[model samples]
Target: MSTAGAHTQHPEHTPGASVRRTREKGEPRFPDGPKADPAGSHFERRIRSFQPRRSRVTAGQEEALQRLWPRWGFDVDGRQRLDLAEFFGNDRPVVLEIGFGMGEATARMAAADPGTNILAVDVHTPGQGHLLGLADQHGLDNVRVGNGDAIILLREMLTPDALGGLRVYFPDPWPKKRHHKRRLIQPAFLDLAAARLAPGATVHCATDWEPYAQQMLEVLTAHPGFENTVADGGFTPRPQFRPLTRFEGQGLDKGHVVNDLIFRRVPHADQPADRAGGDHGADRPEDRDAAGT
Candidate 1:
């Protein structure tokens, strides 16, 4: 999907970025909220650690997302609320699909199983209009779109363990090696994602990039709270209702390998802290290795 977000004009990070703190040398806390920086505050720390790349879509293209910002039909709950919540409708299982371009797969899934409600995030306007139209056509009340940074929406806004599952499909690779840091799948993002996922809920990610697939495996495989549910060479067909995007079909024709990574959320022992491969990988019975969607 063409994103509301644009690619970066400059590299987000420079050499020696790791040692430097993005904030002031010695930061003071605000009495009210985070904005009380006695000195004139700079937003570099807030927008992104590195400079955030931005792209300006045409006015027409930007309209849909603008329309979406106001009350988006329904909240996480089955009830009507002014706000969107991770556990919006009491305790109904909520699934999040990031960057649900045009709602093709999302609409199909919601139609297939009306029991589950899906909260989808995307910045693209045309896609939002397309999805909203489709949902209305199908009379699907289960799908909702929250337009903006999926990262911020998940991190700053949502409550912990609030989501039953998550799906990220075909995110921009940001192909340049140096720009790989700009990719959505990363340690920081995973840590936040882990906190919102309920135990037994699955996080599914798919990509057409072979190297990014391996990179995802390397990073997520070591996560303490998530376990892979596939064999060393396991492959799963696209789940039912996942429409074939033009690019995906083209990639298949060109013989590019598509990789899917599915992970299960491991329950936190007692402490509700983030786990990144601490003793969790130790006890699983070697024979119980399973495959995932």
Candidate 2:
């Protein structure tokens, strides 16, 4: 299939000897489809929470990318701001989903809730194609595929309080202690997410890795911008709105204890526009101290 923008190296180039082959000077993998490096050189580089996976795209998936991408897919190029209402052709509240594996759950969620727009972001080419194909197959007009680093989309493309909700399901745990900083649920990420999410919006995250789940809980709890939906300040039961994917089912079969955290964005005094006020009780001293602010 098309490999447009499919470089093996991280987007942020590493110095020294390179192992991956360089494409010829003017070669374009997929001229009419999602770009390989959508946000190339547009923003400062940093440690990323995800790795781009290179896989063989099936004929059907390739066809979907070539045929449907122009209609529903977008490159997170960090070049301009996106008007969510115009992007989805409606004023429906948009929900941002980071790292949808094959997009089965995303498609399901969109099909179930047609009123809410789902902007799913990921770096996997096959999964991107698969999701596109699924969206086309199921007539999921509410679904949109975003290609490239999610951080760029959040930090550059979306405006403050532009999103109604955020979903991070089964993110890479970066299991090694040394690579914990690469984890996506860090305090810095929460800060950015909180800034983009509207007041009272839910930030739902699920993970099977115990340590990562605990870390997510701790960081989210400490953030002054969020408050747990559960009154006990613990993990909440998996809500019906979030479909159980086959990957999650396999994890359950293997006895993995999946933790779902539902934290709501708290309206801040600083954001006058977002001060519609659901619950602003996150200004506690302990929460600020834990957030190291």
Candidate 3:
């Protein structure tokens, strides 16, 4: 799955980037929304799980975004459920990957399983561009990228039982005791994930942070709609499919422990009716974890 030998043209050297400019001139951006602020401005109105970071997009990334976004990317602002078949041009099982940093693993998984479409979501512009560029270079039609709030995408854009699997690898630990609530894997998140997952769909999460892993385990185990895949009710071995990412390797070198928790969504017949109708918490300042998704 190594992207070795893939087209390596630098942004300055890449040709035909004008494709984006030409298309943008005539396109109406779908799912447009107001930009979020840093100090919890309007975004703070909702409990946000992530803090918007400032990062510059590379020229290559810029061009790729301009050219590829209209077709494969979307903003985090629509209220209607997206038709998966219409979006991807096929109804293949959709795997939603949240916060796919730089998309090394996302690309590998998408490429590995042609039968599944990988919808990679994140807020980082450069990362989104890099992933899109890789997708184009590799001719991976099964991969689509989203830029915006994953929480909004889950709560609004995707319908219940619409996802086949979800992968959240290496989410920010928000290690500070005071900021622990900002962690993405929470009871509400599990509730939301469970609601969107089809029966038997799996949620796989991995983290190099131990305390965060514990929180994930406890929250996931407690969710009635999700059943842990492990027999002893503990972390499972990293499946062969999940590649060893550079970030994970760096953590390993620093003696950081990594944990992976896999839980399957229970069938509708097995779900407790009360628990099945999950409370889709809205944007509010006080709900720290609510914002984290």
Candidate 4:
């Protein structure tokens, strides 16, 4: 089966360096689909987007995308595909989660509240099935899935004030010294996230990787649109709304420390249009132009 519980240098297995062997070619894998090929790269053709396309999104695939996905969709230009009235059940706040592994924590959060909708993204089918299964089990309609590069979805499709919050927990921490470019917590992503958030919206990220945690803090602090919600840095006790997943429980047992960073979008009236810095709408060169908010 495919490695279900690991990523590059993940705490679960010391990343991939210690593994004596990885899945061989043609090896069968779980979720058993095009994206789940153990030997392939989920972000390479990069449907979550953010890269040149070697693949295409077809009709059936779109239908599956519609089904497997939550109500949100970004067009080619990275704009919202639906109106606010259609996408939300109420004017209730929305939270977007990037790379939720296996839907464990997500399901718990959705079950805890009916007034909020959390959009969770990832590229694994079995994980999607697992999340959907859990949601079905709980009759949760508040959770949605975005099965690709969340950056693309955030940067291209979503609009300002489109979200109330964002969450990124334990994403792949591309550790190689040269692979830092591949790390997701970059200026481009932060800007996109800033635009999508309602002023004062929160962007919460957690990581077990020390370097990544540090980088996230610096990048977020430097960005003009946000400020750390907490006065001091370190694990913000898992808020009661977010469930403590099995994986997180394992991390606690291993003496690994998880760092959580929360940043709030400076309000719109207080932050000028220029502060938007070219990320104004879904049109890409940024929705707002040249402004840093």
Q: Which candidate ranks first by lDDT, i.e. highest? A: 2
**Model 4 lDDT tens row, 1-293:** 12132223324443112223355787633222324322234233542222222333333332333243333322222334534445656566678888777788888877866667777767654456567656766888777665555766675567767887788888777777777788888888887787788775677888888898889999998898887666564335445455677887898899977877777677666666555422312221111111122
- Models sorted by lDDT, best on top: 2, 3, 4, 1
Q: State TM-scores per candidate.
A: 0.66, 0.85, 0.79, 0.67
lDDT of 2 at 30: 53
Model 3 lDDT per residue over 1-293, tens place: 11223224454444434223224564542112122321223333566788766665566776566677767776666546788879899877788999988888888877877778888988876788789888988999999888778887898789988887888999999999998888999998888887888776778899999999999999999888888878789998777678899999999999999998888677698667556424221121112221122
Report the Cα lDDT for candidate 4.
0.61
lDDT of 1 at 188: 81
By summed lDDT, which 10 consecutive residues of candidate 3 come out lowest?
A: 281-290
lDDT of 2 at 207: 97
Candidate 2 lDDT score relative to the true structure: 0.82
The CA lDDT at 63 in model 1 is: 36
User: Candidate 1, which segments miss by more than 4 Å at Cα?
Assistant: 1-90, 231-235, 271-293
lDDT of 4 at 244: 73
**RMSD (Cα, Å) of candidate 2?**
9.4
Prediction 4 TM-score vs. true: 0.67
Highest-scoring model, TM-score: 2
- Specify the poorest-scoring 10-residue window by lDDT in model 4: 284-293
Across 174-197, the per-residue lDDT of candidate 1 in tens digits comes to 778888878888888889999987
Model 2, 1-293: lDDT tens per residue? Answer: 22333223444434322224356888765567779899898788899999888876665566667777777889999999999888899877788999999899999888877877889999887788889989988989899999999999999999998888888999999999999999999999998998898786778899999999999999999999998878789998777667899999999999999998888787676667545533322332212322334
Candidate with better lDDT, 3 vs 4: 3
